[model samples]
Structure formats: C-alpha cells, structure tokens
Target: MSEQYEYVPHRLLRHRVRDIASGVEGELMAVVNENVSESGVEHWKELAYIRNASGREFTTAVANVVPT
Candidate 1:
C-alpha cells in the first residue's frame, strides 16, 4: 500500500480522463497534490497517489485527475 488517508478531507479523483489525448481509460483512484506551485505548472507538475474503488493503489497525472 502506497498510503491511505481516511476520514480526512481530500480531493476524490477518478482515473481515465476522458479528454485525454492518449485515449487511455485509467483506474478509479483518489488524488493528492501540493497546494500551489511557484512555477504555476503544479497542475501537471506531479502525480496524485490514489486508491480505486476496487481498493487498488494507483497514480495519475495532476491534470489527468479531477476533484470529485
């Protein structure tokens, strides 16, 4: 297990971004990120580690994930 956060306020994100140009459907997972990057490239700067509905851990690009 990478890391699991429960009962904590976090951004719930699902993998497999539809608007993705790669056309890759990803797994369902939660995401995490830094508050604000000085470079302003923070959105796509890093990946947010998350766990899918199936209880599988996964990581996705920041831009590829959205808050739910």
Candidate 2:
C-alpha cells in the first residue's frame, strides 16, 4: 500500500514583523517557499506583503500560527 501525506495550508498562518518599530502587520500566503528569515528565526517566514496609501509596497517580516 502507498502512504499519503495530509495536506496543509500556509495561508492559515499570519506572518508579522518582529520589531513593532518597523510598523508591519500579519499576512497570508498560499505557500511559503522559504521557512527561514534573513536574520534566522525559527518557525517563521517572510511571505506577507503590504502597501501604503501611496501605493508603495513593503515586505512582511514574520508569521504567526494563529491570528493575533
């Protein structure tokens, strides 16, 4: 018999910035290509993206398993 793996969704998670001073927020994605951050934080990834009224884009910092 062949074994099958249960499907999981990354969008169920919310990624937020570690430093509040950065003024970032949580976001959702269909998938996370990378599981590590540039500074190296465990169980976190930068997949969320944001933008201002000016239409400027900013990359998210981290992810939360549960909504905050």
Candidate 3:
C-alpha cells in the first residue's frame, strides 16, 4: 500500500519566533506532529518546542508562533 502522509520539517525550525498569546520569544528547536485516529478518521496535530534566551523551554501549538 502507498503511504498516506508525508513528513516535512516546519519552515520555522532554527528560526526565532514569538508566541502570539503568551508573548514568549525563543528559538524554534523542534516541530512535532502527533497523529490522531478516531472512528477511522486520521489527522495530525502540530506542536513546537522553543528555548528562550534564559534556557527555559516550552511547548505550544505551531499556530501560536510568529516570526520574530
């Protein structure tokens, strides 16, 4: 069977971004896609990991970040 999905690195990787809701600014460290299947349906949830200047890290939805 053919593959149903393709995995690609997010454009913001290694770039600086800020969370729109929390006003947190940091370097984008990684992008993670979590696949969810329910009732024969499948979808992906994109998440981002960021590290701040002070070395603090946090996780947030990819949609919440904007280029800094």
Candidate 4:
C-alpha cells in the first residue's frame, strides 16, 4: 500500500490563480489553516484566500484553484 499525506496549500499563496470550478481568475492572497469540528471529530483544512480584478475577496479550497 502507498502512504497518504495531508494536502498543504501554502505554496499556492501569492500567485495568480484560476478557480477550476468557477473559472474565476484572481491573485492568491493567503492560505489559512483552519481547525474544523464535524460530528465531534476534529480536522484541519487549508483554505485559500483570493482577490480578483474587481477587488472582490473570496475563500476557497486549494484543490479548487490552479496557478495561472
């Protein structure tokens, strides 16, 4: 069996990004590590913050975006 690892979004920060799902382009502003609780289980996730040309800021999963 192969080993599995957690995904980290840090490297994607400060780069231009395009959302795979929405097709929106923007600059990656930050990657935030968040602790989430679900059904009494704790989990850590990385969220990417982005700013578009219109000056709108939004947060999304790193998997949803790619460097453009």
Q: Candidate 2 has which clashing residue pairs, if any?
A: 14-64, 15-62, 15-63, 16-62
Poorest 10 consecutive residues by lDDT, candidate 4: 1-10
Ranking by lDDT: 3, 4, 1, 2
TM-score of 4: 0.70
Encode model 1's per-residue lDDT on 1-68: one tens digit a residue. 22223322344444343214333344544444434434544332345555544555655555655433
How does model 2 fare in lDDT? 0.39
Candidate RMSDs in Å, in order, are 8.3, 8.8, 3.8, 6.5
Backbone clash count for every predicted candidate, in the order shown: 2, 4, 0, 0
Candidate 3, residue 40: lDDT: 64
Say which candidate scores most in TM-score: 3
Tens-digit lDDT track for model 3 on 1-68? 22343444989888999988789999999877766556667776777888999999897888898999
lDDT of 1 at 43: 34
Q: Mark the regions of model 2 whose C-alpha exceeds 4 Å error after superposition.
A: 1-21, 24-32, 35-44, 64-68
- Sort by TM-score, top down from the best: 3, 4, 1, 2
Candidate number with greatest lDDT: 3
lDDT of 4 by residue, 8-61 (tens): 556767789998878889999877666665676767777777899999998788
Model 1: lDDT of residue 15: 39
Model 2 agreement with the true structure over 20-68: per-residue lDDT tens digits? 4364344433333344434444344444344434545454443423343
Clashing pairs in model 4, backbone N/Cα/C closer than 3 A: none
